[model samples]
Target chain A: MTESVLASWREGPVKQAIVDFVALATTPGPGFVAVADRIATFDNDGTLWVEQPLPPQFDFVFRRWAQEIKQDPSLAEQQPYKAIIARDPAFFAGVATQDPEVVGALLAAFARTWKGTTPEEFDAQVREWLQTVKQPKLGVPYIELVYKPMLELLDLLRAHEFRVFVCSGGGRDFMRVFAEETWGIFKENVIGTAAEYRYADGRIVRAEHALGSLNVGPGKPEHIFAQTGRLPALAGGNADVDIEMLEAARFSVLVSHDDEEREFAYTSGGEASLARAKELGWTVVSMKDDWITVF
Target chain B: MTESVLASWREGPVKQAIVDFVALATTPGPGFVAVADRIATFDNDGTLWVEQPLPPQFDFVFRRWAQEIKQDPSLAEQQPYKAIIARDPAFFAGVATQDPEVVGALLAAFARTWKGTTPEEFDAQVREWLQTVKQPKLGVPYIELVYKPMLELLDLLRAHEFRVFVCSGGGRDFMRVFAEETWGIFKENVIGTAAEYRYADGRIVRAEHALGSLNVGPGKPEHIFAQTGRLPALAGGNADVDIEMLEAARFSVLVSHDDEEREFAYTSGGEASLARAKELGWTVVSMKDDWITVF
Candidate 1:
C-alpha cells in the first residue's frame, strides 16, 4: 500500500477516524458526499498554529499599539492600551479564554486604527510583517509556525475534492495576506472578522466599523454560512470559542494542547471544550500523542 | 478565422469593446491580469435577467404577501403589503428605479416573514417559486427569463479564466438556489443582501434582521469586496444601483433596455445609470441594436 499522506500524524484512533471519514465520504455509500457537498472548515489560531503566547493577530496588533503609545501618550487611557501597558494578568486571562467583551473592545480599536486605509496599503503591511516578525520563543518567523499536521489534513481534504476554508477570529484581510502563501487557501476561502468596507469615488477603503460581529463561538458558523451557505461535513477547532462551529459539523476534531516540550501546553482557553468533546464523543487529539512532529 | 463566442452580440462597438478587453487582458502585457486578479462581477436583476414589469424577486415576494394578507388581514397595514395591495404606482416606480428607501423597507419585511426558517426551508420556497410561478407577461417561469446574451457573456468571461460572480440586491441564499444550475456559477460566488443567521441546536436558521444594509449603490461594491477582498477587473450592470460597482471596475458594461419588441424597452430605472455611463465613458449596450437574441 502507498504511504498515508498524513505522515506527521501517528497511526491512532484520532488519525484513523479522519481517514475513515474520508473513506466513507468518498466511496458510494450512505455517508457518501458529492463534490459540491464536501466542505471542510478549520479554526486557525490554536488548531492550526500556536496560540498560547496569545493569538498571532493579537500579537500583530499589540506591536503597533506599543509604537502608537510612544507618539500618543494619552492613548494608554483606553482599555486595550491600559491593559497592555499594565501587563494585567486578568486582561490577558480574558483574552486567553476568548472573552467576548475583551475581544470586542480590541476589535473596535483595531477597526479604528486601520480605518480609511485601502486594501492594497493594508495588504503590503501584513505581508511585510509576516516575513519579518519572529515568534519571541521560537526565534523563527511567525508564518513558519503554522502546524505541519494541520496542513497535511488540509491537503488530504483538498485531494478528496473537499473545499477547505479557514474560518478564524482574526481580521479577514490580515489572514488573507498570508493564507494563500502559507496555507494554499485562496483569499476568498478565508472568512473571519472583517472591517466593513466603503466604496466611493471609484475606490474602496476600509470603514471604521467591523463588517459583522466577531467571528467567535456562534459567529464562526454564521460567517461560514454567509460564505459557503452550508455547515461543514467536517470541522476542526481547539478552543472554547470554536465550540459552536464544531458542534454544527458532522465530525469534529478538538486539538488538545499537552506537549510543553515541542509546543506550549495548556487547557487555558479550551478547558470547557476538552470536557465537551469527551461528553459528546467528539475526537480529542493530544498534540504530543497523536502527532509524530510539531512543526 | 473563428466565429465569435459572443454570437448573440451584433457586430458593434459594444461587442468589439468586450473582445478587445479580453484580448488585452489575456495577452500578458501591461493590460494582462493574472488569473488571481481576474475577478468579474455582474449585477443580476436588469443586467442578467428581466427586472421589468417588476424585478423577479419583488414578484416572488409580492405573491407571498398577497396570500399572507388574505390570512392575516392586518399584514396589509404594513408598508410593503399595503403598497402591494394597492398596486401603488409610486412604489412600483421606486422599485423599478431601485430606490434605497423602498428597497430597505421591503427587505425588512422579507427578513421578518422568513425569520426563524432554516436555510433548507427558505431554499425550498425559493426553488418552488422559481419553477412554478410564471412571469405575468412572459408566460414562462421566471428562471427562463434570464438573458441568453448575458449568459454568453458570463461563459466568455469564464472561458477566459475570469472568476465571474453574481452580485445582486436580492437575497444571497435566493440567488444561490439557481446560481450554479442557471449561471454555472457556484453558490459561494453569489453575493447579495441576506438574512442575519442564528445557530443553535446544531442547526442554522435565518434571523429576523437583514445581514447588512440594502445592497444597492455603494452596498453592491461593499458586499462584493467583503466577499472577494478586491474590486472587479470587469463588471456589468443595468441600473442606477449598480453605478458604484461598475464605476470601480477596470472595464464596465452598462446594458441599456431599448428593444420594446424583443424585450421591454423602458430605461425608467436606468436613466441615471445611462447618464453616468456617458460621463464615465462606460460601454453602453443597447439591446435593440446590440443583441441578436433577447432570450
Candidate 2:
C-alpha cells in the first residue's frame, strides 16, 4: 500500500482512533460539527513538540533571566532568580507542569523584567534567542524538535476544515513569534498565558503583571471561550495542566512520552492526566509503540 | 453603467477614500499589505449601529437590573441601580461615552449580578433579551439599527480579504449574542470588555470580576494585539474612546452623526474624536452628506 500521510504514526489503534474521529467529525450526520465551530486546540509543549528535560519556553525565558542576572548580579538575590541560582528542582518542575503558584512566580518575574518594552522589542529578543540557543539535551534548535506524528495530525485536522489553535501555559507572545513559521498555523491561533500591555506614544508596551491568570487547567478553557466564543471540538495535550481543556473538548487525545530510547520517558507531571485519560476513555498516544518516528 | 456595490454611500471624498485605501491594501506594491496582515476593526456602538439617546447594551442590562430592583427593592440602593432608578443623565452619558470610572462601576455591578453563570447561561439571557427588547426610540429590534452604509463598507473590506472584527467597549458576551447572525462576522470577531470565567465541575462559569481592564481607550489596541498579535491596518469609530485605536491604524474613519433628518444628530461623546480626525487629517463621513440611506 502507498505510505499513509501519517507515516510516522505506526498502524495501530492510536492512529486509527485519530483517523476515525476526523471522519466522524467531518462526515454529515449527528456527529458532524458546523465549519465555524470546528475549533481544534492543542497544548504546545508535549502535545506538539518535545517537552522532555525542560519545556522550550522555560529554556527561552530562563536563559533571558540568566543574562539579566549577569548584567546585574543583585537581581540574583530575588525569589525566582535566587531559586534559579540555587537550582530548585521543585520550582522548575512546578513551572514545567504549569503549577499556578510556581508559574505565577515566573510570570511576575517576566512582568518585572520585561516592563517598558514594546511588543516589537520583546519579539526581536525572542527571535534573536531562538537563532542562538539549542535545546540542551538534543543539541538542536528547539523548533527543530516538533513531533512529526503531531504535525501529520494537525495536517489531517486542517484538511478536514478544523481551525486549529495552540492553547498552552507558555507565554502567548513567545509562542506567537514562531507559531506561523514553525507550526504552519495562523499567528492569531495561539492562546496562552499573557502579559498586560499598555499603549502609549504610538507603541503598545508590555506591562509588569500578566494579563490574567496563567493558562493552566481551568484557564485554558476560559481563554479559549473568551477569545473564540466556543470550546474546542478537538483537543490534544499531555499533562495535568491540560486536563481541564481536554475534558472540555468533544474529543481528547493525550500524548504519553513513554519512549526512553527515543525521547524522555518520565511522566513528570502527567501521571494524574494519564490516569484520568484511562478513567474517561480519552484516546492515548504511546510514543514508544504508536509512533515509528519521534521527531 | 452598473451601480457601485457601496450604493448607500453618495459619490464623495469619504467613499473614494475608503475605496482607494482598500485598493492600495490589496494591490501588490509597497503599500500592499499581505492578506495575513489585512485586519480591519470597527467600533460597535455608533460605528456599526444606532447609539443615540442610549446605547443598546445598557438598555438590555439596565432593563434586567430594573426588573431585579422591583423584585428586591433593596437592590435599588445599589449605585448603578440607584442611578438608573433616578434617571441619572451624567451616569448614562459617562457609560455611553465609555468613561473609565463610570464604566468600571457598571462592570462591577455586572460581575456582582451575573457571577456563577456559565457562558451558555449568559448567552441565553442575552439572546432572550434580543428577542423581546426593541430599541426604545426606533421601536425596532436593536440589530435592525445597523447602518446600511457601514455594512456595505464591511462587505467591501471582507471582499478584499480583510478580516473584519467588531471591537467594542460593550460587553463581549452581549455582542456575541447576535454577532454571527446580524453582522455576518464570526462570533469570535467580537472583542469587548470581558467577564472573568472560572471552570469547575465540567462547566466553565463566570466569576465576580471583569477580566483585566475595561476595553476602552488604550484597551482597544491592547486587546487587538493580545488577540491577533498585530494592530489594525484600518479602523473605524465614532467616539472619543476610539481615538487611540483610530490613531494606531494606517487609515482611520470617523462617522459624524450630523444627520438629524434620517438619524439622530449628536456628538456628545464623539467631540474629541472628531477634533482628532480633523487634526490628523483622517477621513470623516458625514452621515447627512455621504449616505444615500440611513439604515
| Winning model by DockQ | 2
Q: Could you give me the TM-score of model 2 versus the true structure?
A: 0.95
Instruction: Give the Å shift of residue A139 in candidate 1.
Output: 0.6
Lowest lDDT sum, 10 consecutive residues, model 1 chain A, at A92-101
- Using Cα atoms with residue i matched to residue i, what is each candidate's TM-score against the true structure? 0.94, 0.95
Q: Could you list the CA RMSD of all candidates, in the order they appear?
A: 2.2, 2.2
Stretches off by above 4 angstroms in model 1 are A1-4, A92-104, B1-4, B92-104
Model 1 CAPRI quality: medium
lDDT of model 1 at position A234? 92
Model 1 CA lDDT for position A232: 89
Clash pairs for candidate 2: none
C-alpha DockQ for predicted model 2: 0.76
Off by over 4 Å in 2: A1-5, A96-104, B1-4, B96-104
